[model samples]
Target: MALIPKETELQEGLTTIFEDLLLKKEGVKKELIRTRKDFNIACDQHIKSGFQSEQDWVNANASHQNKFIEYEMYCHIIDIITDFKDIHGQFPEYMEMHRTLSQIMIKLAQDEKYELAAIAKLWVDRIESTIQEHSYC
Candidate 1:
């Protein structure tokens, strides 16, 4: 017979995972803010000078795009966490979160955002490994 983890153990594990995710979310948010500011500054400078160097525009645009994607990804994560909490009154099961992450990974890949997709894949792998570690079979 497989030994099941106690409710408290599961809760503790979930708490740790949630905390880590939240921390990452905060970091993403900070980067989003900074990138937004940089993008705006770049635009303002272009408008004021009536010209922007090609390299400067490219750098600012790339940073804006990357941070926007990251912000969207973090928003999805927040939505998943919120919905799970609202429905279950607790942190989500690892597999449940994995399912959502898998969908995100596929969507990102479809969008040709391979780097973001890879990050999502890493999250999926981490959750699966957590599930495996907790399983007793």
Candidate 2:
């Protein structure tokens, strides 16, 4: 569907020349239409990703180069906390995070990212405590 701009303050600034280019040049008009199509495609894909919130998008893109320890840690932590709040308890997700962090902790500790390693270790400890306190029946 062609988008017809309604009369508004921005329409008042259309300034004639811009409209002429769009009206007279088929290529310019086609490109403008393509932009809208591209935008809709992007929105559809973003919706399909099961994106929960802005934080989920941020964490998904936070990895740098080939290193992913920090972003992985952040995602796992958020998952645990969000699940805890939503369910009034927890699940095995934290145990999986503990395993992943344990594998990376050594490398992180040896590098400048030791602080993050420490945080992951602390997260593991928290998961352990949660499991112990809230034993499964």
Candidate 3:
């Protein structure tokens, strides 16, 4: 029988995306489990803080021209997820999270929160492609 995989790979990918622009300058991956309201509150706070802590306020504010979060980070974040399974072995739990994340992205996009969804889309697409590629392996 083929071995089912663990979630370590998927978990790592999701964590990287969370840290980029969650409205909270500092947060953990598990925070994603919170309600949408809580997630946005955190994202708003992080964006308002200018993506850095108070200690580096001046430099950070000046370095970033975007007053609101943008989808640019999605590119790099997606790239990392694409390499995830390779770094952490494949597992069934990993697949489920990939699917769930895609669903979350859809909801976020429908709500017009495209910045984060843009990243999710790439991750989801990558996951689908990977699943297909490995289906017969």
Best by lDDT: 1
Point out where model 2 deviates above 4 Å.
1-90
TM-score of model 1 relative to the true fold? Answer: 0.76
Model 2 Cα shift for residue 28 (angstroms): 45
lDDT values for all models = 0.73, 0.47, 0.51
- Candidate 3 residues 76-106, lDDT tens each? 4444445443444433354665666677788
Give the range where candidate 1 is weakest over 10 consecutive residues by summed lDDT: 85-94
Order of quality (lDDT): 1, 3, 2
Residue 64, candidate 2: C-alpha displacement in angstroms: 16
What TM-score would each prediction reach against the true structure? 0.76, 0.32, 0.39
Error of 2 at 65 (Å): 16
lDDT of the structure predicted as candidate 3:
0.51
Ranking by TM-score: 1, 3, 2
Instruction: Give the CA lDDT, 0 to 100, for residue 1 in model 2.
Output: 100
